[model samples]
Target: MSRERLNVQAPVHELIAARWSPRAFDARPVETEKLASCLEAARWAPSCYNDQPWRFLVADRHQEGEAWQRLFDCLSPGNQTWARRAPVLILACAATRFGHNGQPNRWAQYDTGQAMMSLVLQAIALGLAAHQMGGFDAGRVRQAFAIPDEYDLMSVAALGYPGDPAVLDEETRQRELASHQRKPLEEIAFAGRRGLGFMVPDSLGWKAKVGQSACPGTIRISIRTWLKPWSGLGSRAGGCSTWAPAPAPRRCPWPGGAFRWWPPMSLRPRWIGPGGWRSGKGWR
Candidate 1:
């Protein structure tokens, strides 16, 4: 059984929530048909303007003599530490120019990411484990593979069956056993404006499980603490309200009787010229 499962905030497809990256991969050769199926899944990924920009350079350890070693050597030492156990290595790349117009395709990398995700998900569905690594010698990969300048080497992936945790060293094994985690939805989802968090109803059964003490003034905290005050205190105070432990005097209003309350400066919604709400910040 897989050691880790997603600690998801809300319900998700079982496949999606079950998929995870593991450093301990069994030394078993993945079937050729399975590899082809994973690639086929990537082939169908939607790209910008229907320009399929993704490409893959595969090396099977069970096949030819030096091909697998070449690919393994291209990986960074830290990645090679565990990735070497996998029976397959794939070099994911993308064409920088649009095939149709030959113009620089800024979306190439983004499209390639989607394609890689498709490949990963397919591998997961096939009862395989795939771990993508950004730590690699791009220059070495290009030189060794004779890659054209038009292609960008995006990432490397190690694919195989899940292996024994005992095969991994203590530190890696510990990480492999750790629970899967993600940022709370309150941190990512936004309301009417940026920085204002859209509170997911408690009925959804989603709550912050991770300690956020390190980031006291983050947008998530600000929004969670301020949204209620903005609506409750602002409306009752005749427009805007400041957060206070005790009742305080009402602050001055804007030009058009718009209530202005003191909240964290970062959480303040931008006031556009009459009838528009603008937020100067961008969400992640």
Candidate 2:
């Protein structure tokens, strides 16, 4: 028997299942309105005390070519080598304090994450793909971008359409181009704290069976339009996915298909089944 958990709502499964991380991107430019709409979605995301601490410093790939190059230069030599081809790059940062009250809020990081989530999903909704990188050199980024002392440097994001994964060199094409998967449900969602065994609420039980998944604030977009398809959240899988070129050319010539990078970036094989990866027409 497959025994794979069937507990996730159809929509929730779609969203969680569709999301992926990538290193290769087309050099094609993203339109301004699409970018703005994605940011607007993030702007409306719910926040603690409505602080909305997230701020973005975006370098338009073509217009700010020099600035973009500088940002790329700051990346670890390995990332700089390939990220040069990404169409858009953004620096995600968070304010140090809450807006309503001057009290230092420690939730800025979490709130920023929410905003980025909104950004990524919005990109997905806009027929675009976004890659988030944590393997950056903070000091170099801070120095190269003149990032201030106050805001915490969160992530470097690359945005563009899916591209030919074969563009990666032989060694890298084999290793860094492989797919990634998430942790199992049992290790993430808990009925109680760590070391204390617990079960999930029937209401929240899907997470326990499928590992940590989407938050209530997450939204789902149908293939027909970028608009929100669900009004309320009770645990619905978001039916979302992005398309990439076929992977046959991307497979490693080596065993396990593993290749290496300095602080090797993780690559997730994109989901390409029903309501998953698709082309200009019909659902796959």
Which residue pairs come into collision in candidate 1? none
Candidate 1 lowest-lDDT run of ten: 213-222
lDDT per residue as tens, model 1, 3-116: 322223333443454466889888779999999999999999999999999999888898744888998998888888888899999889999999999999999999999999
Which sections of candidate 1 miss by over 4 Å?
1-6, 204-284
Query: Candidate 2, residues 1-284: lDDT per residue as tens digits?
Result: 00111122223435344455556677679898888987998898888899999998888878798888777776776776667778888889988787777778798989999999999888876667778877688888888878777789999888877566558766555444444434544556656578553432222111111111232111222322122224464343222321222224224321122222111011212221322323221111
Against the unseen true structure, what C-alpha lDDT does each candidate score? 0.65, 0.58
Angstrom error of the Cα, residue 131, model 2: value is 1.3
TM match of model 1 to true structure: 0.69
Lowest lDDT 10-residue stretch of candidate 2: 204-213
TM-scores of the models, in the given order?
Answer: 0.69, 0.66
